[model samples]
Target: MSTTRTILICSGKGGVGKTTTTANLGIALARQGAKTVVLDADFGLRNLDLLLGLENRIVYTAQEVLAETCRLEQALVKHKQEPNLALLPAGNPRMLEWLKPKDMQAIVALLERQFDYVLIDCPAGIEDGFKNAAAAAREAVVITTPEVAAVRDADRVIGLLNTQGVQPVQLVLNRVRPKMMSNQEMLSVDDVTDILALPLLGLVFEDEQVIVSTNRGEPLTLSDSSSPAAQAYGNIAQRLQGEDIPLMDPSQARRGLRARMRKLMQTRIF
Candidate 1:
């Protein structure tokens, strides 16, 4: 039996920041001295390597390791800056037709022996890709926006995860705009939690810095960035490690935004 925490990072709908959360969370966990490996289970459209800036360094993948063509260490692409973290693609996109749930299980079983955390970046939707990813995961973090459709889809995904015996499914509400939420223009945190009925693991506010970091192949949490999203990711990682950190307050976030705007005006006037 392995003590590794195998967690699947998934979202029912596309463009909900599933991969972004997985990438940043992996870096955050590794920075805290945990041996983490992010397994890109969305191999058919995998971009986790690109996000982590390890795309060019991946000479092999889980497919090669499973096929006995390469060693697991050879397939693992160690992060250049965060050596405590590694990235492993599930398979080559062209050759993923043969991938199945058992294959995913096999790959993860091997990973569990060496890593303290195995974060699987699952493909969007409730298709075969999702089923295969869920098969190997002991727990999951379902990402969603404050949109009705995303929440609906996440609810369905949670049901599927339950059927698969994935324990302790947690929720990560992404793309949160504090102003909109406060103004009732978007779904309130309470609204989402009431629908999903899962423990709120974290809240990621909408930030332009996330786009900047993604395009540069550097996750926001990889550095000492003071961005709200970065701080939120770090806090989430702390909570995952069983640290009793309090969740961020949306009202406080809105007030903080107002203060920043006021400071900008003062700086320009001076």
Candidate 2:
């Protein structure tokens, strides 16, 4: 199949679940028969392999290609769980300068020739690793948790994406607790979308399953079934396929307007 899409999952701050989003979205896309790949561009701090349960199997990473030890295709590890999905791990112990922007373009350009979609897992912070990931993808997904720090960083990343001429900065709000949001205690969907001024790809509620799944090196999207967060990510995958999937409302656990209005005020005054 011809590749026509590339998505870079990025965050200006750390601990915002960019890797997790990249992995699961790739799974979701692959599930829909889209030949997909998640490139771990977080050189020297790679974790997409571990997140996808392919850590131990990664012998040749992206670093190998940049170091001239192997070709780009030589480093890819097919997902143990996702038949249609594959992963390209990051740096190697001997290769520290693996974050070069051209290497990323070369690798992703090669991937685009074979896969339908390539999702890049960007490193945290606006540094060399981040630039490498941005150079590989034509579009971007800014992942942020509904917290002060993550949101601030996400805003900065969105600005950078725009500056790069990356039209359409998509937002993925992760780890949201609607109960707190409704209580006017946390940031709501509106709060984040308004500040970033971007289209929302998904809203992942704070789910215990996510942490549990991550620890097992599995993405929640695989067996999301009735899980709200899983369902949200799945819908996001469908959207990427050019389908107009309707957004699902978070469970009462997500709360209602009284809480949303409260969240609005809390964010405004802060």
Candidate 3:
């Protein structure tokens, strides 16, 4: 059996942090001494390169590699800070018209020979883009927020993944607001897992730092930042490597937030 783990990071709906998770998770895995490459399969938007700060460095893409105009080594853009991680840029949006499952498989097959992990950043929604991305993946990570619409969409995607024979699909609940969840405002983690019927991989809190990092074209895991989302991504990477780490509880998180707020107020008062 091939040891390369080709995982598709997908979400059935947009705006659910799918690309963000892919970028962070790729960096996290690389930091842990894994040879990881993130393949940008979202040809329409192709934001993975931007998120990884390799947008300007992309001279060629998977299209050129497959067309025999350029070699695979010429097409891959390695991360400047993290040498262990590299990115395979997606083909032009026009490739979607003629991109077959075999073409995706061919690309992934080439990648599998060199890397320990191939993280495919799938396009959002259950459409042609999603189908093409899922075609080459051996496993999948389904990202969803705590919103009802996102969860509903995730459940449908899970069913589709099952039909496609993707094994051991996991869920990562992103943009979770502990206060709202504790107050019965947003859907709880259990609510989502119950509906999707997949193992919960990790829970990322709604952090403002995520926006700051993305705008700066840096992943939180790249630096030793103390961001909760960064830690969550790292933990998710560790769990993916078969490490035993405890999941963070929303109630505890809420309490920790209150404590931090109290400490800040007291510092200002004193």
How high is each candidate's TM-score? 0.95, 0.88, 0.94
User: Of 1 and 2, which scores higher on TM-score?
Assistant: 1
- lDDT tens per residue, model 2, 1-270: 554688889988988788888888988899889899888878578788888888888878766666789987778889887789999876674575745788788778778888888888888999777877787779888899888889898988888888888766788888888778877789788888888888888888888887888899989887646777788889889987779987656545555679888878889674
Every candidate's lDDT: 0.94, 0.81, 0.92
User: lDDT per residue, candidate 3, 180-264, as tens digits?
Assistant: 9999999999899888989999999999999999988899999999989999999999999889999988887867667978868
| Candidate 1 accuracy as TM-score | 0.95
Q: Which segments of candidate 3 are over 4 A away from where they belong? A: 257-270
Ranking by TM-score: 1, 3, 2
- Model 1 segments more than 4 A misplaced: 256-270
Candidate 1 lDDT over 1-270, as tens digits, reads 778999999989999999999999999999999999999999999899999988889889899999999999999999999999999999999987878999999999999999999999999989999998999999999999999999999999999999999998999999999999899999999999999999999999999999999999999999999999999999999999999888887866877667978868889674
Q: Give the lDDT of residue 105 in candidate 3.
A: 92
* Cα RMSD to the true fold for all candidates: 4.3, 6.8, 4.2
Cα error, residue 33 of model 1, in Å, equals: 0.5
Candidate 1 clash pair list: none
**lDDT against true structure, model 3:** 0.92
lDDT value, residue 77 of candidate 3: 92
